[model samples]
Structure formats: structure tokens, C-alpha cells
Target: MPDKDRSQRVSDAVHHRRWLILTILLFSLFVVVLDNSILNVALKTIAAPPPTGIGASQSELEWAINSYTLVFAGLLFTAGLVGDRVGRKGTLLCGMVVFGLGSLLSAFSGSPGQLIGFRTVMGLGGAFVMPATLAIIMNVFERAEQPKALGIWSGAVGLAIAVGPITGGLLLEHFWWGSVFLVNVPIVITAVIAMVLVVPDSRDPHPGRLDPLGVLLSMGGLVLLVYGIIKGGQLASFGSPLVWATMLGGLLVLGLFVRHELRVENPALDMRYFLDPRFSAAICAVGLAFFALMGVTFFMVFYLQSVLGHSPLQAGLLLLPLAAAQMFFSPRARLVVDRLGTRVVCGGGLFLVGLTFLGFLSLDTASDPWLLCLLFFCQGVAMAHVMPPATVCIMSNLPRSKAGSGAAVNNIFRQVGGAMGVAILGSLLSTSYRHGIEGHLRVVPRSQRDTAGESVTATLAVAQRLGPAGRALVQPAKDAFVHAMHVTAVGAGLAAFLGAAVVLAFLPGRGRGPCADDDRATPGSPPATGRDEPDL
Candidate 1:
């Protein structure tokens, strides 16, 4: 067979088997999304008896979550490019194996530090998994087929986020908290087996040579940037030199990394994609969407656990309303995006999420838990409308050749937003908590008041020492924390509204039609033009 003839045959094969390709792609995506949220519900379970030699406040509690996202966000672009250069199948298999190994390690961790180390390994695997899946979907499907496939992809993602917390909660109840990590082991092993059987090997036909320096610069820049977000609140003062250096240095490095890519013959990251407005807009929307999500997750969980004093299981159950809303409305979301346009659906969704947060201000720490579910349910409805459509628009608009990189870019911003959302929200919650605690403590006797003013970690310890009085003080401190969380909720909702403003202004309407570069996903086609980055 001649080379040209064989290429044509392969193209035909890809189009014919696109659905199978999409299934494989979404399953891998399921794993990546699942682990991100699964552990949040476990925060309390792990903190309860507290792992051997682990203290909730002193331990690397946040690090366990932050590390995975940090690594995932930082290395994602390089991984995408690597997949395009190497075989996507090989890249994916490598990622799965590492992910499985990390899950196994997390299950057996004897200390908080150790668990975090392994989670970082999982994040490394995530960097590979996320882009490869999206790239393959692009590689296999035609442009017209992308929205339907992406809708399905988004649905799987919705299911993952919805199921993760519930699954984690079940794991904690049936076994130890470690079981939460153990749950990934079987899922990963199964995915690996399926990959060997189902996934096709694909790569960039005219792949450029790898740029080692560009890779390092981009990855290092992301690492530093995320590191700053994770540690910013812990800094002695908001304007500390160390925090400034890391954050500033990270941005500088990323800027240099972009410049390096433009200069290099075969850049690991192709900066030219940014030149395309459609692609840029898509990436921007994804970032903002996740930013809203991360903020909600960060504050809502504490609102349930710290404010309302719900058990981990109880809190997990409350989220079911949000999950249910997504499940019920997902199909509708797809239809709306296809008919009304991506911007209208996404912008409207953000408005709802903002309203949910705004409405939460009506409650105090003593507010009814059932009413809180109404807010959670609104969030669910909001997410169901936005997520799938936004993903479809972004993935569809990007060129097929750069699909992996495009998805990776989107995922990276989402992770960064997730990290920052948590950091910023956490800081706000903590600051407000201190203020609320101080005001409440003033009404109590000196001996009783000091415990309320103590650090959250210290109060937990003093409760053990104080006997009945300590338990009495617990309610007061918790009340303070709850009031603080209420304030945080109002602020987070408003921030989401701000993110929506960006979408309303720049995002294109659906029925208006895709731009010229829209057909850019055509296989064996040249580069695309005129797409915006959907952003954070």
C-alpha cells in the first residue's frame, strides 16, 4: 500500500470508530476528575481519629489535596505535547501505571507527609491522562461530531464529581479513611486493562522535536505559581518576601517559557495557539468555571462540617441534591448549548451560582441544614447548565493537531483556578473565623474565652483537657466558625458573578455559528486560525 493511501484508510477508520474512541477517552477522564473531589469528604474522616502521628492543623492536611493539583496544573502542557510527539497510547499507559502505583501508596501511607508525596505522584499521572483523553477524542472524531461527544464527555465528568464524595464517604464508613485511597486501585487497574484492549495509538504526524528547556521553564513556572497560592495564607504577613518571590518568579518564568517556546524550533508548548481568539476564549471560560467550582467546594464543605457540625457522611449526603440536579439537567444543558449558544448557557449558569452564594448570606451558623441544601441544589443546577457546554465549545473550537495541548491548556487553568479558589476562600474563612470568634469570646468569662480565641487546632486539643466546660466552649467556637463561613459564602458567590461578566462580554452565541477556524479539527489539515482561548 502507498503511504498516501494508507493515511486515507486510517482517517476513514478513525471516523468510523469515533464513538469507541470517545468512550475510552471519557473513562480515563472519569479517573482524573474523580480523585480531585473524592478526597474532600475524607478531610474530616482522616482528621477524626487522625491518622497515626497526624495532627489535623499541624499535619500537611491541605498539602495532600494541593500537591496533586499543583503537579497536575504545572506539568499538564508538557505532557500534552509529549503525547503528540510520542504515541498517545504509550503516554496514557505510562500515566495509568503511575496513577495506580500512587493510589496503592496512598492507601498505605503511615503519615500525612507520605500520603501527600504519593498524591503528587497521582497528579503527575493526571498531567498525562487529562490531555491524552481529549486529544484522542479530537483525533478520532470529525468537527461536527465534537459537541455530542464532548457533551457525553462532560456528562461523565459530572458523574465523576458527583460520585466521588459519596464514594469516599462510603469508604470511610465501611473501612478506615485509608480505604478512600484504596478505592482508586481497582478502578485504575481496570482502566489499564481496558486501555490495552480498546485504545488506539495516535500521534502528531508532523510532530516537532521536543524542547527540554521550554518544558522545564513552563513546568517550573506553573509549579512556582501554584506553590505560591497553596502557601500564600500561611505566610507571616500578606506582603512577605518569600511569597512574593515565588509568585512573581513563577509568572516571570512562565513569560520566559512562552518566549522560549516561540524561539525554539520544536517547542514543547506552542504559544501560537494563544494567537487564536476562539481557543483563547474557550480556555478562559473553563478556568473561570473551575474557579467557581473550587471556591464552592472549599467553603461549602467547611460550612457543612465546621459550621453546621454535620458528620462527614451527612455532609456528603447533602451534596446529593447538587449531584441530582446535574444528573437530571445534563441533557437539557447540552440541548441549550446546541440551540442557544455556549455563552448564553454558561453566563446564565454563573448567574445562578452567584445567586446561590448570595442567598446563603441569609443564614447564620444556626441556620437549618435543609435550607442549606436549597443553596447546594441551586449550585447543582448551575453547574449542570454550564460545564458540558463550555467543554464542548472549547474542545470543538481547537485544531485537531493541537487538541491534546488545547485540552491540557484548559485543564491547567482549571487546576490553577481550583488551587487559588481554595487558597483565597480558605484565607477569607480563616480571617473571618478569627474575627467572629473574638466577638463571641468577649461575652464569656476569661477562662472560657481564651479557648475560643485559640487557634482552631489548639481548641481541639484543649477540648480534651477541659472536660465538660471544653465541650460547652466547642459550640461557641463552632458558632463563630459558622458565621465566618456564611460571610465567605456571600463573597464567593459575588466573585463568581464577576467571572460571569467576562463570559457575557466576550463569549460568542451558539446559533450565531462557529467561526472560520471551526473546521480546523479536520484531520491531516493545516493549522487553524481565529479561535479564542476560553480562560480562567
Candidate 2:
């Protein structure tokens, strides 16, 4: 057969397998994202002492989550660059292997410090996995189908959000705390095998040289920043000189990193991307949305388990409505955007999210479970609208060859925003709880006051040790936590509202669709006919 005929046949084969390829990519993405939320249900268990738990303090638990997020966010740009330089498929395979190993290590961790370290390793692998999946989708799907594909991809994240806690709950019910991490192994193995068999390899033919300094600066800046935030939370005050020093230093380094990127001939991340209003607004919206969502989620788990007296499995089950809304609406968000425009849809969604956050203000120790579920579902719907449209805007603006970079920007904002949410909102929760419960701790010994004031769990633990006397501390601790949650919710709600304002002001209106032609083009790109060719 002629070479032209053979090339046509290969193209047809690839075209037919695109959806299959997407399924495999989603599987890879699922496990990476699953780790982000799976720990929520287990945080209480992990905080327990001895063989049952790791005895991690609230600050340590925050670190456990943020450790993964910081590393993931910090390495994302470099990982995207790696995916573009090496094959995305290879990057994905290697990332999954590394993630699997990290998960295995994390399962057997004997201490909170060790768990934090192992989670960081998992983040490194996750950094590689996240961008590669989106980049691969960009290459596999045509522009017309990109929105649909992205919607499905976003929904996969929602699915992970749903599955993670429930899976963790189920495992924890029967198995040890390590079982949460251990569960990742089989999923990783299955995804790896499927990807090896079906996923096509793609890379930038003329990739830019690696920027080691930029990578170092980014990682250093993020770690310092997050550490400072966590430190402030641990101390329950931002007045510490150490907190200010680290935070300021981090900002300085990040500023310098931006300046360096602008001047460098071959930059790690092109600073010019922010010049696009759509891209910048969309990225910010995503960040802000996750900031609210993750922060609220961090506290809600505690509310369900500690305050409301629900089991881990019960808490996970309660979140079903939220996941259901996300899975149902994420894929259909594009349709809404097409009808109402990006600005309107995203802004409206964010406003709804803000409302949902404020809804938490109504909950107390005896609040109706149905009301809680309604709020979760509404928040999930809001998230569905926000993420897909914003993501589509960000990715569609970039050239397909730079999909890795585009994906990195999208995810970096998400992870960083989430990390900040956990750190900042968690600090607020801690500070508020301590203030409310401090005076009541007069009954407790001075030596135990600090630990008892640290968290609801600590206070309750102290109460439990006091036997019948401890019963008095329980109601006060619950009341203090509720107050703290309300305070955090107000902050998170304000953040969401601010995001709504930003997107409404800046994101593109309905005048042009997301996939409008830009200047960048592949050298030998085929013309887009606004439709996929029929499969062979």
C-alpha cells in the first residue's frame, strides 16, 4: 500500500479509539485526584494515638494534606514541561509507578512526619499525571469535541471526590487506617496496564530547554509560603515573627521567579499567557472556586464526624448529594455556557457557591441532615458550572502543542488555592475555636490546656480521660467548633463572591465561542471542519 494510504488508515484507527483513550486517561486521573479527598474521612482516625492511628496533631494533619498539594502545585509546571519533552504516555506511566510506590510507603508510615514525606512523593507523581491526562485529551480530541471531552474529564474529578471518601470509609470500617493508601495500588495497576495497551504517546517536537532555576524558585517559594501559613495556624496567631519572615520571603522569591521567567529566552512558564483576559480570569476563578470548596470540605468532615456524631462511613455517605450534582452537571455545563455566555454562567455559579457557603451559618449541632445535603448539592452544582467553563477557556486559548503548559496552569491554580484554603481557613477555624473554648478550659489542668484548646478532638479526648467530668466539656467543644466553622464559612463565602465579581468583570461574554481561532497553529495542521470524520 502507498504511504499516504497507510497514514490514512492509522489516522482512522486513532480516531476510532479516541473515546477508549479518554477512558484510560480518566482512570489515570482518578487515582491521582482520589488521594486529594480520600484522607478527609480518615483524618480523625489518623489523629488517634497508638496502633489505631498516627497521633498526628491538627497541624500535622493539615501538613499531610498540604504536603501533597504544595509539592503537586510546585512541580506542576516542570512536570508539564517533562510531559511535553518526553512522551505524555511515558510520563504518565512513570508517574503512576511513582505514585503507587509512594502510596505503598505511605500505608506503612509509622509516624505523622513519615506520612507527610511519603505524601510529598505522591504529589510529585501526581504532578506528572494530572497535566499529562489533559494534554493527551487535547491531542486526541478535535477542537469541536474538546468541550465535551473536557467536561467528561472534569466530571471524573467529581467522581473521584465522591468515590474517595466512601472507599476510605469502607476500608477504614474493616481494615486499618493504612488501608486508604493501600487501596490505591490496585487502581494504579489497572490504569497503568490499560494506558500501556491503549494510550497514544505525544510530545512537543521542539520542546524548550529545562529551567532548573525556575523550578527551584517555584518549589522553594511555595513550600515556604505554605509552611508559614501552617505555622501561623499551629500557633493560632499570625503575629509570630517566623510566620511573617517566611511568608514575606516566599512572596519575594515568587516575584523574582516571575521576573526571571519574563526575561529568560526559554522560560518554563510563559508569563505572556496572563495577558489574555480570558485565560487570567478563568484561572483565577478556578483557584478561587477550589479555595472555597476545599476549605469548607476540610471543616465539614469534622462537623459530620466530631460534632454531629456520625461515623466515618456515615459522613462519606452524607456527601453523596454533592458528588451526584457534580457528576450530573459538569458535563452539561458547556451547554449552559453556550446559551448564557462564559461570564454569566461562571459568575452566576460562583455566586451560588457563595450562597452555599453562607448556608453553613444556619447549621448547628442539631441541624437537619436534609438541609446539609441540599447545601452540598447546590455547592456541587455551582462547582460544576465554574470548573468546566473556566477550564475550557484556559485550554482552548492555548495552542495544542502547549496543552501541557496550559494544563499545568489550570491545575497549579487549583492545588495552590486548595492548599491556601486549608491553611488559611484552617487557621481561622483553630483561632476561633481556641478563643471560644479557652475560658471554659479553666476546669482542665494548665499543662493540658494548650492541647485541649488545639481542636475539638483534643478537647474531647481530654474530656474522655476525665471520665464523667469530661461530659461537661463535650457540649462546649461542639459549640466552639460550630462557631469556628461559621467564621470560616463567612471567609470562604466572601472569597467565592469575590471570584464571581472577578469573572463577571473579566471573563469573555457570549460574543465569541471558546474555540475561536487564534494566531497559534500547528505547522501541518489539518483544517477543522467543525465536525469529526466518520470512523472507519
Candidate 3:
């Protein structure tokens, strides 16, 4: 056969195999995202002293979580650049190997410090895996089918969220806390095997010289910023000099990094991509949406476990409605977007998210479990609408060669926004709880009063030791947390409302579908545009 005929046949074969490749990609993504939430249920277990646990103190436990966040968020941009330079498939496979090794080491860690170090290694691998998955999808699928493909990809994240906690709970019930980390090994092996057999390799055909300075600056800035955010949330206060100074320093360094990118001959990421309204607005919307979602989730866990008297397993099970709604709606969100437009779909979804947050005001200790489930379902539906459409906007605006960079930007906003939410909203929750419980603390000794008022968990522990006398403190602690959660809900709701307003103002209305103007563009070239329709 002629060369042209042979090439056409190969293209058809690749197209046919795309869905199988997507399945493999989802498996890779699942393990990476699963580690993030799975560790939550294991924190209490890890805090116990002796062979059963790590004997990590509260501060040490906080560090164990923060270490992962700090590394993952810090390295995401550089990792994306690496994926674009090297082959995405190779980067993904290498990342999974590193991740599996880290998990294996973490499972057998002897000290809190060792666990923290191992978690950081896992974060490094995760940074590479996350962006490469999306980048590969962009390369594999045509523009016309990108939205549907991305929707399925987004749905997998929701599935991971539900599975993470439940899986952790089940493992802890039967085995050691390290089982949470150990579980990742088999999943990684399966994904790696599948990937090796089916996934195609792709990279930037015109990748320029390396930008070492850009890498250093971005890593330093993100590390300092995320560390400060984690510290503020842990302390439940940003008033400390350590928090303010570190965050400010991060901002300053990031400003310098941006300026350098603008002037550099071969930038790691093109600074000009932010000039596109669709790209900028969509990323901002993602950030704001995550801010509200993460903040609400942070408090909701405490409400379920501490206030509602649910076991970790029961709490995980109760969250099923939320995940179920996401899995049901995320893949279908594009169909809604096709009718109503990206702007309307995403903005309305955010508005609904705000309403659900406000709905928390109706709940108390006596509220029915069914009511809670209903609220969670509603919130999940809302988020399903926002994430998929907004992601489509961000990715569609970029050329295929820049998909890794675009994915990195999307994740950066998510990480930073979630950090801010947990810090600022958490501070509000802590302050309000302390104020509400201060009056009741007089009954306890002065030394224990401060510790008791620190958190509902501390108060419950204190109350349990005092037996009948301590029983008096239980009702007050629960009431205070419920009230504090109400206050935090209002703050989170406002963030969602702000996100809705942003998309409505800046995102385009009904017009051409995403990537319509650029569907015919060849690799390594800028996207072509001539359509009179709206940008997104």
C-alpha cells in the first residue's frame, strides 16, 4: 500500500483504541487522587502510640499531611513541563513506579519523620502523574470529542473521593493503619501493566531549552505559600508572623517568576495564555469552586465523626450520596452545557453550590440523616456541573502541545484555593468554637481548660476521662461545633457565590462549542481562529 494509505489506516486504529486507553488513564488517575483523601481516615489511627500506630503527635500528624501537599503543589508545574519535554507515557509510567515504591516504604516506616519523608516522595510521583493523564487525553482525542472524554475523566475523580475514605475505613478495621498506603501498590501495578501495553507516547515536538531558573522560582514560591497555608490552618490563626511572612515572601517570589517568564526567550509556560478570557476565567472559577468545596468538606468530617457519633466507617458510608451524585451527573454535564452554554451551566452550578452551603444552617444535632444525604447529593450535582464545563473551557483554549501546562495550571489553582479555604474558613470555625465553649470551660481545671477549648476532639477526650462529671461538657462541645459549622458555611457559600458572579461576567455565552475554531490546527502550531461565535 502507499504511505498515505498506511498512515490513514494507523490513524483509524488509534482512534478505535482511544476508549481502552482512557480506561487505563483513569486507573492511573484513581490511585494518585485516592492517596490524597484516603489518609484522612488513617490520621487518628496513625496518632496512636506503639505497634498499632506511628505515635505521631497532633503537630506531627499535621506535618505528615502538609509534607505531601507542599511537595505535590510545588512540583506540579515543573512536572508538567517535564511531561511535555519527555514522552507523557514514559513520564506517567515512571511516576507510577516511584509512587509504588514510596507507598511500599511508607507502609513500613518506623517513625513520623520517616512517614513524612515517604509521603513527600509519593507527592513527587503524583505531580507527574496528574498532568500527564490529561495531556495524553488531549493528544489522543479529537477536539469534537474532547468534552465528552474530559467529562468521563472528571467523573473518575468523584469515584476516587468516595472510594478513598471507605477503603481506608475497611483496611483500618481489619489491619494496621499502614494498610492505607499498602493498598496503593496493587492498584499501581495493575495500572502500570495496562499502561505499558496500550498507552501511546506523545510530547512537544518543538520543546525549547530548559528553564532551570523558572523551575527553582516556582518550586520555592509554592512551597513557602502552601507551607504557610498549612501552618495557619493547623494553628487556626494567620496572625502569627511565621504565617504572614512566609505567605508574603511566596507572593513576592511568584511575582518575580511571572515577570521572568514574560521576558524569557523560551518560557517554561507561556505567560500570554492568561490573556485569553476563557482560559483565565475558567481557571479562576475552578479555584473558587474548590475553595468552597474543600472548606465545607473539612468541617463536615468533624460534624459526622465527632458530633453525630458515627464511626469512621459509618461516616464514609454516609458520604455515599455525594459521590453517587457526582458519578451520575459528571459525564452527562456536557450534554447540559451543549444546550445552555458553558457560562450558564457553570455559573448556575456554582449558584446551586452556594445554596447548598447555606442549607447547612437548617441542620442541628437532631437533623435526620436522610436530610444530610439529600444536601450532599444536591451539592455533588452542583459540583459536577461546574468542574467539567470549567475544565473544558481551560483545556480547549490551549493548543494540544500546551496541554500539560494547562493541566498544571488547573491543578495549581485547585491546590492553592483549597489551601486558602481550609486556612481562612478553618480559622473562623476555630475562633467561633473557642468563643462558644469558653464559658463552659470554667468547670474544668485551669490547665486543662485551654486544651479542652482547643477543639471538639480535645474536649471530648477530656470529658471521657472525667466520666459522669465530664458528661456535662459533651453537649456544650457538640453545640459549639454545630454553631461554628454554621458560621463557616456562610463563609464558604459566599466564595461559591463569588465564583458564580465571575463566570457570568467573564465567560462567554452560548456560541461555538469549545475548540471549534482550532479543531483543524496541526501539532506544534498556534490554534487557528475565524468563527464569529463566542470564544467558549
Candidate 4:
């Protein structure tokens, strides 16, 4: 056969397989997003199996969700590097196998500790898969086609993020606690089969030598830093020695990793990317965007269930609007970004998020459901603009050789931001709600004092039990929740303001001289205005 014919055959194979591979990758991505929130609804069920575990504390339960993402963040950079050296197909298949085993383990775990252990294993799988997906997508699609392909991918995950809470709620209502973990099995099995058959193998032709020291540095540093961030609230009042040591130690390790990367022949994650303004700006935006975005989502779940007296399923169903609206708009996001550019579109998104947060602040018990849906819908619209385009900017700005590493770094920042979001927003709400509840109860008349300790449902039960007196006290509980919601929304609004400020200041403005409408990924080319941003 002629050389051209062999090349043509290879190209044909990739072209046919791309869509099928995309379907499988999207399913894998969905597992990560779904599991992130699915267990949230099952917490009550998981804790209900026995006497001692029947009423787990909030922190004990939160760890179930936090542990997965935390471990995933720590392993991401190292996993991506390993995948690039090994064939992406082999790496992805291995990840799928490992992840499937974890799901099975989690489904059968007898205790929270055992479940967390399984989830940590699942996070290792996620680290393997996440960067592999992005790099594989970039490789499979031609440069011109990558933005649209990535837009679809981003939209899929965004949809999952919005829908996961609701889906978990629906499943938990109808099924057993283990059903949440069991659900991933069929989807992942299908994904594994499809991926093995359809996804083409790809690897870096000049892959760097493995750097074990770099891996240790990154993993150790990330573990310490993220754990510190997650535990910061508990340590805030006390300022414990471990807290200081871990945080400072993590910083030192990260610094050492950077220095090693700069000096080594083949570093695990090349630290040079920090020099690129476009990449740097894109990464910073990833962190800040999730800082506000996930904070709002984390609170909304609680607000609906705890504050508004909605059941877990009902709360999940209500958030269906957010996912639904984002899906409705996601396919068109890249077009909007192409016409408007990342800066304008992303800035506009932040502004809209700020507006929607204010809408949340104004919500009261008697407020119409449609009004709340509208606010979430607005948030969805903002997300469609921010997520896909921002990701395209980050990936496209990188050298082709470092695509996997770039994706890993971007992913790490997002997860870190999410962890921070939960810690900060959760602490504020817990503190504010407790204070508000206490104050509201104090003002309650002696007549209705006894009924105040009752659950929201219990209070409703006694509304008829205590007649008009019990009914009057019901208003106080509602008032307290609404006031706490006000504080949460204000915090989200301020977070959005801060995030948007960073975008406006650092991200290149629209209508510039050379980079004005540029989306090219030309290698070794000079940046616009003759300024050099460091290479990744």
C-alpha cells in the first residue's frame, strides 16, 4: 500500500470513532458529576441502617462527598502526565476498570469509613480519566473543530452538575441507599465497552520521562493545601498547630515543585505555563468562577430542603430548571463566544450571576416557585457562557505537547475552588442560620415556646395541635430561614463581584489590536502587542 493510503486509513478510523468515543467520554464525565451530588441525597438513608449511625452529624456526612473530589484534585496532575506517556486508550480503559470496582466497593460498604475508602479509589480513577478526556478530545478533533466539540463536552458536564442533585433525590426516594453507587455500574460498563471499541489510541510522541519526585511533591502539596482549606473553618477560632504546619508545608512543597519543574529535564508538570498571560488569566478565572458557582449550588440544596420545608426529592426537582435551561442553551454557547469573545461573554455571565443571587436573597416562603425557577434559569444562562469558552481559551493557549498537563492543572484549580466554596459558604450559612434561629426563638412568646423545638413538619402538625398559637410560631421559623437565605445570597453576590472584578482587570478587553478576535492556537507565534506570556 502507498504511504498516503495508509495515512488515509488511519484518518478514516479516527473520524468514524470520534463520535462514539465522545459518547463514552461524556458518560464517564457524567459519572463524576452525578456522584459528586448523588450521595448527598442518600446521606440520610446511609445513616439510617443502625442505632449509632442513625443520626450522623453534618460534618460526618459532608465528608462522603468531599473526600472524592479532594482526592481527585490531588491526583489529577500526576495522572495526566502518566496517561500521556502511556497510551491514552490503555489509561482510559484502566481508569474505567478501577472506577467500576470502586463503585461496586462503595455499594457494598458497611460503614462510612469503608465507603470513603472506596470513594478515594474512585477519585484515582477520575484523575486518570479527566485529563485523558480533554487531551483525547483535542487530539481526535481537528483544531478548527475542537472549540465546538469542547463546547458540547462542557455543556454535558454542566448539565450533569445541575441535574445530579435532582437525579440523586429521585433515586433515593424510590431506591435503597446503595442504589446511588449501583447506578454508575451500568453506565460505566457501557462506556468501557464503547470506548475500547471506538476510541483511537494516542500518545505524546516525545513524552517526558516520569518524575516520581514531582508526583510526590504535587500530591503531598495538594493534599495538605486542600485539606487545610476544607478544615479552615474548624481551625479558624483555635488556630491549631497542625493547621499552620500543613498549610505552610503545602506551600513549601508547591514552591519546591515549581523550582524542580523549571530545572528538571522532563518535569511531571512544566511550571512554565504560568508565564503565559492567556493561560494564567484562564486558570485564575477557572478558580474564581467555581468559587462563586459551586458556593451558590451548595447552599441552594440546603435552602430548598432545610429552609423551605421541601423534601430531598422536591428540592432536587426544583433545581431541574437550572440544568434544563443550561442544556437548552449549551449548544449555542460557543457561537456566542465566537461572536462576542471570552472576555465579554464571561464578564456578562458574572454580572448575571450577581443579579440572580440578589433574586435569591429576596425569596420568602410565600414567594412564587416560578420566581425561584427564573433565578436559577438566569444562572444557567450565565454558566453556558462562562464554562465552555473559558475552557477552550485555556486549552487552546497551550502547546500541543502539554495538553494533558494543561487540562489537569485547569481541572485542579476548579476542584480547589469548589472545595473552598463549600467550606466558606457552608460555614457562613451554618453560623448565620444558627444565630438567626436562636434570635427568632427568643422573641417567641412563652405560649409557643415548647413547640419551637419541633421539626418543621412537627411544627406544622401542631399548627392544628396548638391552634392559632402554634400557627403564629410557624411564621417565626419561616422568617428565620428567609433571613439566613438573605445572608447566603449576599455572600454569593459579593463573591461574584470579586470574581468578575478579576476577569475585567486581567482578561484582555474586547476589541484589542492583534488579539481582538483571535482564537488561533498557533505554536511558536508571537503574542499580540509583542508581549510574551510564558510557554506551557
Give the TM-scores of the predictions, in the order they appear.
0.88, 0.93, 0.94, 0.86
- Which candidate tops TM-score? 3
The runs of at least 3 residues in candidate 3 whose Cα sits more than 4 Å from the true structure, single-residue gaps closed, are: 1-10, 512-516, 519-525, 528-536
Q: Which of the two candidates, 3 or 4, achieves a greater TM-score against the reference?
A: 3
User: Candidate 4, after superposition: displacement of residue 387 in Å?
Assistant: 0.9
Per-model clash counts, in order, read 24, 0, 0, 2
Greater TM-score among 1 and 2 belongs to: 2
Give lDDT tens digits, candidate 2, residues 1-536: 24444333235566688899999888889988888788889888998898899899877887888788777887887888778777788888999999999999999999999999999999889989999999888777765567788888988898788778888899999999999999889989999998888888877655568788987887788778767766766676778999889888889998998999888877777788787777889999999998888888888988998899988888888888888898899989989888989999999999999999999999999888899889989988998898888888888777666778779889988887887787788889999999999989987889999999988988998999988877889999999999999999999999999999999998878876553354233223332322212212
lDDT scores of the candidates, listed in order: 0.72, 0.84, 0.84, 0.71
Summarize candidate 3's per-residue lDDT along 38-100 as a digit string, tens digits.
Answer: 887788789788788979976788788778888889999888888888878888999999999
Q: How far does residue 428 in candidate 4 sit from its true spot (Å)?
A: 1.5
Candidate 2, which segments miss by more than 4 Å at Cα? 1-10, 515-536
Q: Which one wins by TM-score: 2 or 4?
A: 2
Put down candidate 4 lDDT per residue, 262-286, tens digits, no spaces: 7888778656656666667667777
Off by over 4 Å in 1: 1-17, 48-59, 235-237, 439-461, 521-536
Ranking by TM-score: 3, 2, 1, 4
321 in model 1: Cα distance from truth in Å? 2.3
Clashing pairs in 4: 275-534, 276-534
Model 3 scores worst on lDDT over the 10 consecutive residues at 527-536
**Which residue pairs in model 2 clash with each other?**
none
TM-score of 3: 0.94
> How many angstroms is residue 146 displaced in model 2 relative to the true structure, after the best TM-score fit?
1.1
